[model samples]
Target: MKRIKLALIPYSAYALIFIVAPILLILLYSFQDSSGSFTLENYARFFDLSDPVYLKVLWRSIKLAVISTVICLILGYPMAYILSRLPARIRGTVSFLFILPMWMNFLLRTYSWMSLLERTGLINSLIGWFNGILPSALQLPTLDIMYTQWAVVLGNVYNFLPFMILPIYTVLIKIDKSLIEAAQDLGASRGRVFRKVIFPLSLSGVVSGISMTFMPAVTTFVISRLLGGGQNALIGDMIENQFKVVGDWGFGSAMSVILMVLILLTMNVIQRYESENSGGSVLM
Candidate 1:
């Protein structure tokens, strides 16, 4: 008991100083009025459903996060399965190659896509070259993909793909080879084996990966600002605007609190669904 308490003391202190303290400060600020009196006005502003703008922005953020999470899952699962099937000696190197982009500066990666997608950019330039061999009408239309919701989604998927891949890969690598072989020997189809055996075993990883990818994708302001343009604002952008441009720190803090609560609710619902389906057994 003493040893566990001693170990917890450091973590508790760190949490107090960093997480708890900051959250408390936000809560305090969230309840304060412009005149510095305690008030619920900040939160009440969000409850005004008549204002469609807030709901629109919030819904857009949710949609973007959901789409990105879904794409990451679809893409990551197969990649993870392929990597897990590789020989042990080459797995680490391949995994490193997969994750190497995530270690690069996020801002740099976001900006790089701007160069690739901009008008007269790499993609358009290639299209222009290909158009030389065809009638102008048959040429691909020049796209203004930048400053759009698609750009934001693209950036998000790129940024969070590694988060999704790593968790799923970790779970896949630990799957019992004998179980797969037994399923095959029992005359189960490959698809049936994957659906009945592999996917169920990887549910925990899916939950973790979806949570990691979705939470950050929704709360992210930088990618939206850089790629989606300032006009194509998300809830994160609205919170940032309140804090920085509007000078409404109290309202900003309230928005932050709301965002945190939404994320928690989403994760909890996902976990509950996963648990029910998996019969409450954790893969690990």
Candidate 2:
């Protein structure tokens, strides 16, 4: 027992230095002004809409993150289900292939998307070729969605989708085969079996995936900076500017606190939802 407690000492010290210390400093700085005097003015700037930009950027971040999370859920669940049903011998190989892109650099993957979606890039070039082969009116127009909010959302969806998929796949593969067989034997149709038995069983995975994907999507600055162009940016961009450009640490710390609270509240709500729906079909 003494040996095990001693073994944990290094990790405990590391956490105190790296994790707890920074959070404490941020909390302290958030309540202080330039003169290092305590005040709630920085927090007031967040709530009172002293700067309209704060609320606007925050709402936009939440909206885009929600849309990206929903899209990832829609796209990932089907692929996870298909992967879960593959032959046992080949399932690991195929699942590894599904996650191959993630092994590459994240920035490189996003840059590849930039190349594919630019106005004069591959997509538009292919559209132009199709237009040349067809009549005038039949010509498809170029996609000009690059450097827009759509682009940011697309980048987020691409980057975080695997996070959504892998968790659900893990859960699905662990479901008891006998439960599924028993449901079928009891005269449940294939669709009914899925709706009642499989779907309910997988709710935990879906909730976990949503939490994992949405949190990063909401806090992403790189995707917004690269894909959203200069005029369009998220709350993360605002926070970054406050620290790096404006050099206002107090406001930045306050924004950080607000963002942290928002995420914690959302996670609590999701936990409540998971607790309520456990072992039961939401559809029923």
Candidate 3:
């Protein structure tokens, strides 16, 4: 027991100095004004009904994050299912291929997408070339989603899709084959088996994937900056601007605190739902 307590000291101290200290500083700065006096004005500025720009930005962040999460879930769930059903001989190779891009730098990946989405980028250039072979009326319009909300959404989906796929695949691959066989023996159709047995059992992974995907999507400033071009700034952009450009530490910290709280509340709701639904399927 004494040795165990001693072993935890370094880890506990690390957490305190790094995680807990930064959070406490952010919390402290959140409630202070320029003169270092305590004030609610920073939070009030965020929640101001008359000038709801910050609120609008926050809503946009949540909206885009939710859209990204849904798209990831829709696309990832099927991909994960395929991976889970793959033959064991080549499954690792296939999964490695799927996850290969993640080994690259995230910023570099986003920058590559930027090149593709640019007005005169590869996508548009391809459209231009394809148009040369057709009559004017038959020519397709060049892709123009760069610096738009759609661009940001695309970036989110591309970057975070793997996060969604890996978790659900982990769960799906671990599902007991006997339960699935039992469901089939009981005369369940393929779709019915998935609906009744597979999905319910994989809810934990789905919830985890949602949390992982949504949190990063909502908090990301890089994608929005590169793809959104600052016109469609999300809450992340706003928070970043408050600190980096506006030099308003108090407001920035307040936004950070609010964003953290909102994420915690959202996660809590998801966890509560997970808890309620867990084991409800009973392998049926």
| Candidate 1 residue lDDT tens string, 178-205 | 9999999999999999998898888888
How accurate locally is residue 21 in candidate 2, as Cα lDDT from 0 to 100? 99
lDDT over C-alpha atoms for residue 77 of model 2: 100
- For every model shown, the clashing-pair count is 0, 0, 0
lDDT of 2 by residue, 1-284 (tens): 78878988899999999999999999999999998999999988877765676788899999999999999999999999999999999999998987898889988888888888999989999998998899987878789999999999899999999999999999999999999999999999999999989988998999999999999999999888888888668889988999999999999999999999999999999989998887345355
The window of 10 residues in a row where model 3 has the poorest summed lDDT is 275-284
Q: On a 0 to 100 scale, what is the lDDT of residue 150 in model 3?
A: 92
**Which TM-score value belongs to model 1?**
0.92
- Name the best candidate (by lDDT): 3
Model 2 C-alpha RMSD vs. true structure (Å) is: 2.0
- The parts of candidate 2 lying over 4 Å away from their true place are 279-284
Candidate 1 lDDT for residue 50: 78
